[model samples]
Target: MHDSYTEFILPFGSSPNILEEYTNASGGIRTGKLMEHLDSLAGSIAYKHMLGPGVETVGNTKEMGFYIVTAAVERLDMLGPLNPARDLRLSGQVIYTGRSSMEVVVKMETMPGEFDEKEETILLGRFSMVCRDAHTHSARKVHPLAISSPEEQMLYSKGEDMKRKRQTRAQQSLSKVPPNSAEAEALHTYYLKYGQEEELDDISSSSQLVSMGDTRVEKCMLMFPQDRNVHQKIFGGYLMRLAYELGFANGAMFCKSPVRFVALDEISFKLPVPIGSILRLTSHVLHSNASSPQLIHVGVTANVVDVKTGEEQTTNEFRFTWASIDESSQRKVVPETYKEAMLWLEGRRALEMGDEIRGLRTQK
Candidate 1:
């Protein structure tokens, strides 16, 4: 119980001098920057809890060194606006543990000031982290979480449910296997209703027939020392920022107006990005809200390439939800290939789920 949970605090100054490179257009904190902080805080919580008791050094536990890498950011929900002069308080607890994985529930809230209430929870995130041997990069066992309270029990249950949902979603994402369910059928119907009648060519007279290709954006950056974590690998949050910025740009273009970030559905880290690797990010529109017409979904994927050989490997996938400034705006994304069709379907599912979550919150 002594190492079951950990907390971190990031106090903000009164002035706007701390403005970061990724601030939103209105000068508010960018969602990607918040995610970067969450990843680092979650990793710290995992490290602290894995140490059990009587571990002095942060690099080792039980006389063996290990490495922790973010496997996935299951979900990140932004409840309200975060402004300057608001300090952030982050708390993380190890709710569930597997043979080589740990699920940390991280809550981020803003303190209006020193004299204000601390109940303003702005973001809540769930991170899945995997432990590995420092030398061999092989999977390593982690200390099991100790739960002794009812609240902890409830969180443990939720962790289990999230894990199961992740597995189901991953299985559903496979392109080869056709999903045989009512939900999948409904998604297919929705796509056809919003889909274009013909494939978009290079020259289209009407601007309404916007191909998914038109919103495509590509960015490349070198993983420098500043972007690395304690393990010498590129920080998950930095990569998240890159993906988010690209997605934001693409969504803004798709909507032809400024957009507001709604949620981050998921960010999956498939492989570790070593320092000095050339990281490439590709972003494009996946779907648009058929019912609301003002919401759009963007997909951002990351790849790493060897500087010398030019060999490339996929690293991460970041999914974002954005809302157009004008509620009356209507746009359709036409899928050009089967893979693109699947991405569109997935985006629809993400938007639907986000709506459900928002609905539940409203009810509460």
Candidate 2:
């Protein structure tokens, strides 16, 4: 684990030009742009683990015989707000490894301030990377992780558990099976309360519920070669940034207020989007909490559009949670169709997990 450990520093505080590139409209660091950097950092960590730390260049893929690709982003949680006024450090190591896959956990922290001499963690994320044979384009074996300490052992155990949970969740995906009994009952209850047009039309109803379909925000753009990775394909990080920005916009539109990013619940890279493909990103408010400190779960799907055939193939799916900056925001999302209801339940589950993780952190 120590051999694979890596760190990169972004001097946002000291570099005016660098900070300017990352600044959002509101003067805060751009979370989506930060995600791109994190993805790149994870890739670097994975390579450093496979190659020696002293290796400076990847050289040639043909000579290396194997290449890495991001399989999925397990989760990225915001433990604290980003401070553009301070330098930031990104660091992580290869915590676990399978025959052909590596689990890399990366984190972002604010550098110690002049008055406060302790660094503060701001973000934590896990990236799943897979190695493929350069010639055969098949799974390639990766070096095993060396766990020497109890702390390293614990992290390895956690990574193993995460892989198992991912498999279980995939088996129980709504596309493959019906929701469990409790989720079905809850959906029925929600339908009775908000699915009926008559109930929603009643002026006496205090709930400000909006149909999930009404909260959509979309963008279509041509994928350029300039955005390609080493493989000459569209970079996973670029797709992540696009999905995140779309989700953020959808959340803000649904809440009618500026939103603070809470978490990137999950991202599945189904297929490698080719360069020059028309990329379409569609986002929707999948679920919402109307209580104070309103929370919204936004889902985004990225598709590769076939211009000649007028068909679209989904290449990626992303789930993100955002909270309204105004605690008084009280908008809620209601599903009008079975498919939408399933998405609502999935988003709810993601938010619940985020809440549980945050609760655990607070206890620590």
| Model 2 per-residue lDDT tens digits across residues 154-242 | 99999888888888989999999999999899889888877788865652354477878778888999999999988888999989999
Q: What is the number of backbone collisions in each predicted candidate, taken in the order shown?
A: 0, 0
List, residue by residue over 61-148, the lDDT tens digit for candidate 1: 3346787889999888878767556767778877888899888888877766766755588777889999988878889998877787
Query: Best lDDT goes to which candidate?
Result: 2
Clashing pairs in 1: none
- Given candidate 2, what's the lDDT at residue 140? 96
Regions more than 4 Å wrong, model 1: 1-4, 13-16, 19-23, 53-57, 60-63, 114-118, 181-203, 291-293, 307-309
Instruction: Provide TM-scores for the models.
Output: 0.89, 0.96
Error of 1 at 319 (Å): 0.9
TM-score of candidate 1 relative to the true fold: 0.89
lDDT of 2: 0.89
